[model samples]
Target chain A: MDLSSINWLLLIAALMVGATPILLAAIGELVVERSGVLNLGVEGMMITGAICGFAVAVKTGSPALGFLGGALGGAVLSLVFGLLTQVFLSNQVATGLALTLFGLGLSALMGQSYVGIRPPATPKLDLGPLSDIPVLGPILFRHDPMIYISILIVALVWAVLFRTRAGLILRATGESAEAAHALGYRVIRIRLLAIACGGALAGLGGAYLSLVRVPQWTEGMTAGAGWIALALVVFASWRPWRVLIGAYLFGGLTVLQLNLQAAGMKMPVEYLSMSPYIITILVLVLISSGRGRISTSAPAALGRTFHAST
Target chain B: MLIRHLLAGAAMALTATGALAQDDGEPLKVGFVYVGPIGDGGWTYEHEQARLALVEEYGDRIETVYQESVPEGADAERVLTQMALSGTDLIFTTSFGYMDPTINVAQKFPDVNFEHATGYKRADNVATYSSRFYEGRAVIGHIAGKMTETNKIGYIASFPIPEVIRGINAAYIAASEANPDVEFNIVWAYTWFDPAKEADAAQALIEQGADVILQHTDSTAPLAAAEQAGGVVGFGQASDMAEYKPSPRVSSIIDNWAPYYIERVGAALDGTWESKDTWGGIDTGMVEIGEMTDAIPEDVRQEAQDLADSISSGEYHPFTGPLNYADGTEWLAEGETADDETLLGMDFYVEGIDAEIPN
Candidate 1:
């Protein structure tokens, strides 16, 4: 209720911690979707990553290596999806769904011995001097390294998608595979690589949850963050900067609701908890409610399977 | 120290390995069928703890076996059958979801003794056992009522099952008893093993000024939430959550499966097995109270101990009479006590509770 007492700085810091998971997952999805492949299995990849990260971190006693293992574990599983969708020419949605169900079952089995045991504690970034500042100290100077890396990824993705010639080719392939193929681009190969990157990023997101945030390997740890990430990809209209905007918005909703409750607001906590999902749905509806043919910069061959015609 | 006891037990396990060839008169094989991973911080952890206690207590007398993360449907029956056929003299089906399968497995292997957790369907060879977890909730409700500065409490319920619903009512009753102005706000994650959602739910509760958070779902997320938000208090369900001590977790309702494990299977081992439905709480030793940490004020601490003593001494029944439905209609007669049968199949929420129970 008192503006003078409201710590906007801590609030921003909370926003970053909360947004990191989705950022990792969504950025990966952006690459995957930008390559003309739709991965409905992001949820599965994330869970598998969570378990693999936890197991590796617990075994190795290094959170950094655990994150690396998580990315590889996710990318490796996504390779299966890449093969089936790109080479095997299987239906993307069905295979992706199966990936989720299988991941759920597998993680449950693998995490059996790990209950109640705490993993090695993650170290927070100690911005020694800057963190000691009065107003700006905690916000910019304090965070897990994962938060910094995720934001860095947004910048890298933006540069790659908009500036690089390779980014142009990838975007061209997503827009029209036949055209890109005619120009001698390895369309399937490019798409597979993009999908793998997305998986690895999403894997990192899942790992951040187990290794740092909640810091426990829980079954169904991702909950619906993957779905929210999926909605975010569209909300951003598949642009990198927009992904950051969308991610932080959802993250803000998450943090703000908690802050509201902390400030003693009488809103039904249930409804406030459900706000992020509700707002995402509304955003999607607004995005989809436009004029004739929903005119926009959508990838030309999005969600369509391609086969090499003899 | 508990940690040393665990380590010493691990050491004893190595020595017990040599007696593998002795074959002490048709070896007593023990099989554990888990509903979730052994690593989860809630229900399965407690069950696994009991399994370890068995290993510590019996040493080489018991041969323990386990199949982790088996679901509670046809898979449970399959696992139970495999264990029974493999000479498992006793099988512990440790989930209420496994009740039907437990009963089914009991009928198939009449010689095997099955002890199920938190359910009441029993056969001649099958027996049921559970803690009056709701009773512990009442004691915390008293603490929560006095401890809460905002008069709002958050309850993260796993499922709308009778066991979890009963906990909600008990917590509400205690909270209201402590402060007539108290209110309960709930969020159903509808899952037994999700930390992210649990954290999100706890955050929502903490944001809304719920200084006390209670959970029926298994995990340390609520305690983690309490750590993030100062002044928030919580309890460890099914196990003593030692991870968060001193401040957030003041007391806990620890599951004591050792006695029941000894009682039910000891008879079956001695050839006196029979079917029975059992529910034991504070009055019995099935549920033991964890030590009160320093977070609790002295007055609240003494009051909590007194309530725990009354329950353990059989001088108190949490769900006593002069109770009313949510609509203010009388459910329990004045001065009337609810017997085990009525309490076992509890269906209505007494007055002062706000959440709806799914049919």
Candidate 2:
């Protein structure tokens, strides 16, 4: 397959770029699921973020504002789900599905005029001569700021979830909303905040996709990425660091298959195309089968309605 | 039995609406069903542009309605039925995946005319239409052949269907004609429109030492990838990606469906609409060779233009004889041109492409 011809440096760079969006979205979703809420609207929120980010970037000539706009848009859309599920006591599953449909339609409408317009460029981190450091520079330092931010967010989330009082309250609420409510924790409010945070991060993921990945706005640009993020949370057993590993693993498989195809590998293209999904599912199965310990790691109150009176 | 009753009720409701439209002096209602969003900047974008043209030509005489990003299958059938029920007199289902659904809906709405794009199956009330995209591929193949210093041409194929297969054969033949040493690396993306995947495929091709790239898929991602990779050349598929012109995108194959759209809508208005298959090529303006930028050498550009002219004039057929399958079986002998039936059901790769067509 002529493996020697491949530029390993460029390949790793592409892998990082490919994994960044999912990593961002997965980490956000990890926080949401950790709070015992299942938001299936990741796809919708991500797409909303994509169009919103692209539109604002094009309008203001600032990619930063565009990302903020994307986050705001996704958070606002998630509020609808929040209102329906938390306040109105609607079914979370159905409401989440509705959010996805609504987000897709709304994004398409908002992005209609923004199509074919390129967003403002998000400049790479200029590390001066440090970026020229042999092998590590290209792999670690030559990426856009968003890549660094995504990793930093993951670290921040890990710390917040493990080493703080608010983290304890949040995890306690997810473990038992009724008990937490009895203990004077605002269960609904905590879940609502988590949903918003998840939506915002998912929006950032979507923004990265449109503003940097493809660098153009198209309808349905998220294209099921949010759903993948949702699945990635479950695959990671709701752990923050595991989410990072899972995202990079999936991203590496995606880039590797394409590289294999480019290397003129004798395998059928269908096999190469389906390899990423198949491997992800296989890994999830393997992990979940490990003494059934990982499966029990799911938040005990996940997908459960939190009614104080009940 | 319940499903049957629902279908009957839906069909009756559609017929009732059709009758009401006839009673009222209403403008002809034309509907379009798109597989991708109109902003896809490729195949659906071209179709949407034609829809706009139809509106321009018959402003007051017709009302156009469109639903985008409709997935193929049961959802598509429901959408087509709903459009017919809502009093759409003529509908254009623009995607190869909508073939069966178009026929299914056409059966219930005999009064509504249906035009399915890039499909072969037709009914008494359904018509199929497609363009000769292979002709355009031949032109790009010539350019890729003469331009490739790596002697490796990467083709990002969408599917193994006959239409995509035909483009591969045409491109390979033209490329080989220019440079017999030219080799092909085909990657079947299995998707019609996914920008990230398309860009990745292009990157893979470039990394594999392919200096020239070709795509039958609908997206400008390949051109963008080529530009990002630096020095690699590609052609725009389905739309003129003029934004990346003169370097990475030296030329493009534009799908021009406006004229045919106007004509069919005109037929519906004149009460002369009928079920028929239309496969138009460069001559009828369905397939257009976009402007060749100055990046292509003058002689190569001129040769590409001449090839386009010949294909348009019917003097040159891209699938003409002396062709063999990849397995070394002779398919077409000397002085022989491929028949419509053979071309419509083509499933084998032409010789020189070192890849198997996935089933």
Candidate 3:
């Protein structure tokens, strides 16, 4: 195997790009789960965002606006889940699944005209002197704005979930809707807002794919990245920082395996193909399992519909 | 006597329609199960194009219905069963993964005829049809080998099926023949259609110094990736991605399934349909090479054209003698050609390919 040919620095840089979408989506799902609501429609929201962002970007020739459009699209779709589960008292799991199906179909229809169209390029953050650094610049500085935004979102999520009163109320509502409601916190409204935020972040992740990664519009282009993001949130034990680590590891392994294969690595391709999923789950489970059973870390009210009256 | 003959014909038509559970006046209902969205602009798009051609050719005589992005396992069987239950006279399951599902569904609906693409399994009512895409691959491989400045050619492969393996080997054989220094870097994405994954594979290849990109997967994502990474050239796969012409997409391998689809549908309509295996190539107009633009040097283009012409005319086979398996076992002696059975079930890499096939 020609291991020398594989550019290690470039591979590291690529892994970040690979991880950004899932990182963005998983961080959002962490927030939603933390707020005591489980929305399984991240895939749906992401695809909706992918198309909405792609169409807007193509029409307006601005990648930034396209991302905003994607966020709006995702939020709108999530609100559908919110309206059904929060107000209409529907099962969160079923609503989330239906949202995914609806999102996939809706995106396909909306993207009928957008197929094969290239989106305006999302330019890299040019940190002039910092970008020229030997080992760090290419890996950390040369990426587009979305990568930073994803990491920033994760950090912000960590801060809010731990430091802010709003985050505490959201967590309390998630832990016990009745207790939070009795304590004068609006459980349904808080859950709805959390779901919307989750969806907007998921949408932004999807936009990162269509606008920056693949940089083209195609039906179902988000593929299973949304599902991976969903899995990341759970494996992270509803923690934001852990979600980032899991996403990078998962995304990094994915890019690394492909790079290894391209480098003519003699490993079994099946093992290499599944390395991302296997390694990510192992590492995260190991990291999170230290505290005890993963279920203990889960929000007690996650997936439990909040009824203020009942 | 004339009136009697006409009456008998009408009675026979009536019986035929009754047996098929349809009226004689109704158009033939044809169902298509695609593994990807039709707008993928590659494999599924080509199949969708053929479906449209079926509509255009038969007009009122044929009615086409299709379900896109159908998963290739139990979901395919359910979709096929639903189509058969809905009185679809003929069904086309257009993906290699649909082989077993097509066979499974075909058994339950014996009255319905099934056509599977890029598959080997067949039943009494099931037919297998696929183009010899390797022939086109050989031609493009020659072009890529000649054009590459780095001598690194990246291949974005789908699954490790015989069809995909055959393409890689054919391309490698021709490419190595053209440039002994050329090295193939293959990455199996394990999917038929995921634009994001395919794009990543392409980017990975480009980053590793591959100047020419080749893909067995169905999507324009690789070409898009190649275009984004300037100086890297690639060929359009399954469909002529003409939009990227004059640059990254130097040429393409076009699958011409319309003629075969039209002929098969006509046979089904006339009650002469029979299960068979069809592996047509450039000579039969099943695979057409897209126009090689000015990006390719004149000498290289002429050489590629000659290679394609020779393959099309059956004067040369892509897998010729003096070849060995990756394990160094003799596969063919000097002046020998591969048999159809061997090509259909190819599982090993030819000599000089440094990578192992993922089982």
- Highest DockQ: which candidate? 3
Candidate 1 stretches with Cα past 4 Å from truth are A1-20, A38-41, A48-159, A162-164, A175-182, A187-189, A227-310, B1-24, B59-61, B85-87, B354-359
Query: B1-359 in candidate 3: lDDT tens per residue?
Result: 99999999999988876755643668889999998888888888999999999998988778899999899799988999999999999999998889999998898989999999988898999999999999999999999989999999999999898889999999999999999999999999998788888888998899989999999987888998899889999998989988788899999999989989999999977778999999999988889999999999999999999999999889999999999999899999999999999999999999988888888
Clashes of each: 8, 0, 1
- DockQ, prediction 2: 0.45
Q: What fraction of the reference interface contacts is present in each model, in order?
A: 0.27, 0.46, 0.80
Better model by lDDT: candidate 1 vs candidate 2: 2
What lDDT does candidate 1 reach at residue B92?
A: 86
lDDT at position B7, candidate 2: 100
Better of 2 and 3 by TM-score: 3
How far does residue A62 in candidate 3 sit from its true spot (Å)? 0.5
| Residue range B74-188, candidate 2, lDDT tens digits | 9999999999999999999998889999998899999999999999899889998999888899999999999999999999988788889989999999999999999998887
Query: Of the pair 2 and 3, which is ahead by lDDT?
Result: 3
DockQ for each of the predicted structures, in order? 0.24, 0.45, 0.66
In candidate 1, what are the lDDT values of residues B1-359, reduced to their tens digit?
A: 99999999988877666454454455588888898767666677777887888778777577889988888799998989889998898888898789998888888888888888777777777777777877788888788888888888888877666777788888887778789999887666667766766776677676656789988878887777687667788988778887678878888888877777767656655667676766777777778778888888899989988988897788977777788888998888877766767666777777886655544
How high is the CA lDDT of each candidate model? Answer: 0.80, 0.87, 0.89
What is candidate 3's CAPRI-style docking category based on DockQ? medium
Candidate 2 residue pairs that clash: none
What ranges in model 2 sit over 4 Å off?
Answer: A269-291, B1-26
What's the candidate order when arranged by decreasing DockQ? 3, 2, 1
For lDDT, the strongest prediction is 3
